[model samples]
Target: MMDLMEESRPDTPLALRGGTRSGDHEKITVNLGFVDLGHVDLLVSEGVYANRSDFIRTAIRNQIERHADITRQSVARNPIEVGLRRYGRAELESARAAGTRLDIRVLGLAVIADDVPADLASAAIASIEVLGSLQASPAVKRVLADRLL
Candidate 1:
């Protein structure tokens, strides 16, 4: 994980602690109407965008920009890790050894490695608050379901 517990200190802005290029991007599926898809294709064909992905990225960026203030406020209010965060068995084991419990709050992707056992995850993680997405084995997901926000 990105260790937001330190970054979310009283004076720090959670959003400012992490870089934009955290190299953790989530793949999402969007259901668009046929007309919208056609319009996106048209934009790509007309050289407005390199491809559909480019067009959608631009559109999402614009929307995020429009609501930048609200996003910043929300990030400030919550202890959020703004980018991708992954936790593996080794990390959880270390946390367990150190008697540290994790209260994971992420705005982007949060992944618990497939190799991590459900019991270990339950012991190591205190809670999960993910705004975007979480990827984990079904067993771990079930164990943490009540703790997920």
Candidate 2:
């Protein structure tokens, strides 16, 4: 049961602002198609993102920044967070070495491949900033909860 007042707050576990955190403020409204949104929504379903808005906001930002020659602002954007399942240990370690850990929060329930077990996910949890992955499966959730919730 979603509260009408929480229209802006989707029932997903994760949510992120469009740009880097700077205590900024801006607002705009535009309609996007369902097909495009479905693709983004898949990421949300896969436990890789928090909600529809997070995926759409990131997608729109990427599409806009793709025309970087004119905007000249792409250089400041954070690296993308897609393709999360394929990430290797070395890559995670490299990012962990950086002063600030990245956010890999997922929302709702999620299913990880059987081949990949909770132990591995447990290790990965240490390398992130916020680990709000409600989507993690029972076993994976148990492994990661110590670091996240």
Candidate 3:
């Protein structure tokens, strides 16, 4: 692939999947207050911290580490997936009884179980004779029919 960084503009969004590496650092410039500068200088002079940079770096690092897990989980659990994982054949029946729809997006080709099972899907398709609307692969339709049958 081309260099995404070169193509991306300054307004492009940046997401840290794994919170960045310790060795990979970027340069930044900041203004410091007189009191803060004096405190940093004193800390460096006392050998408690290497310098102001060290203190600031540690604070930024702590913030990143604190929010990394939250970021990863938030990325993983989608609204659609969340609803699907809690639904199945009986749930679909309940939904219909309550006058709700079971409309779905397959996302990709797969035989994995969730939302709608292969057996239920095949039954629905055969009953309605409209598997075309499901937009599922041919092989998957066979699997659904076979399992349901």
Candidate 4:
């Protein structure tokens, strides 16, 4: 794993590159049981939350706060990228040209831009281990299927 403090780059701000949200956050889908859905609706109707998303976000934040220490330790140990990360064709091409390989480890989201080709991705990226989500073209995914974790 990379050292979190040493390898961290402030320039790489986490932003969902191609997501619907205008903010840096990425949109995600979650499935809930009927009872859980009803409870969320109840909370919204009772004015505890403006909407289901508000309640869910709050709940997730609370949970993360509750496990802050563990989360921090894990992040440090794994040295994974915490926000949104996007890789474009030019980036991959440059890596390939420089004979550099990528061992991608992301805790949030990692996206390979649509313009990137499968061969370029395969040549540049050696491995991938994403804890949250990965967004890549089908051909790229298939080419790197063995390297994904």
Candidate 5:
């Protein structure tokens, strides 16, 4: 089974710690048809749901739960890191020293530390394919733009 356990990184700032905090939420914009919006509003008005967001969240959660088996099978089939993956300067430096480049594949959050220089990151990282989010300095992102998927 995939570990649904929460993880913590002592060096990472709370705000940047994705997959490690239950209270953290990623803002997403969705365009809904008028009919759908009206239905959501009606449910909220009847107190079936607290609000539009709440209703949407609940619906999404239900769908995800319903497809949990598919998600687990996919995760198991892929050779990808499942949760938070943080790469610091020291780790990158070591990879560089060994002449090994990293192909980062993450399903949740991938973070290249702020202190990592653009050149250093480029030297150590071969490619990045993140299913969720990637946090890194602007310079590093710019330098590695071609290598991102």
Candidate 6:
């Protein structure tokens, strides 16, 4: 599984998937006003927060927690998976055999296994709406690009 931990670059043909600890984190940059930055700095200096990043993370977590019920309701209504979801070759083949295509909706990482071919992916997947990230071969991504939301 260590071999699947390769980081993805925009220039690379490969995409990322879940395997290592770092796969759980998707780095994001935040912009803040000077006053807010100073406030965060003061909190850090006062030992209320370890750092700006920590403070931001905590704030984000708190907001998410506060809106947990709403999030749950939305997820339930949309039929979306909240975490890591992988669609493998066998699963797609089975769906194809059943004459059913999947409309994948995920709030987190959605992985199409590396072994899944572009044609199979295109045939088996009707549409994809992912709120976070998607992991698939470049070919599969291209074939499904028109169906992605």
For candidate 3, the per-residue lDDT at 36 reads 57
lDDT for each residue of candidate 4 in 9-82, tens digit (9 for 90 to 100): 33432221233443445564455555666787899899999877678788989998999999899988878888
> Model 5 — TM-score against the truth?
0.78
lDDT of 4 at 130: 86
Cα lDDT for residue 7, candidate 4: 17
> Per-residue lDDT of 1-149 in model 1, one digit per residue for the tens?
12221233334322223332234544444555556667877988999998766776788899999999999998888868988899999999999999998999998789899999999999999999999878899999999999997
Stretches off by above 4 angstroms in model 1 are 1-25, 98-100
Question: 120-139 in candidate 5: lDDT tens per residue?
Answer: 99999999999978788889
TM-score against native, each model: 0.71, 0.29, 0.31, 0.73, 0.78, 0.79
Weakest lDDT window of 10 consecutive positions for candidate 6:
1-10
> What tens digits encode model 2's per-residue C-alpha lDDT throughout 34-125?
56556666887998878765665566679967886644443235332322334344554555456434345332122344444565666545
RMSD of 4: 12.4
Model 6 lDDT per residue over 105-135, tens place: 9988999999999999999999999998888
Better of 1 and 5 by TM-score: 5
Comparing 2 with 3 on TM-score, the higher-scoring candidate is: 3
Residue-pair clashes, model 2: 4
Indicate whether candidate 2 or candidate 6 has the larger TM-score.
6
Model 6, stretches more than 4 Å misplaced?
Answer: 1-21
lDDT of 3 by residue, 1-149 (tens): 01101113333332122322232233343445556556767887999877556766777779969998874575477322221122345765565566654444222122223555554554333221221123344554565553331
Q: On a 0 to 1 TM-score scale, where does candidate 6 land against the true structure? A: 0.79
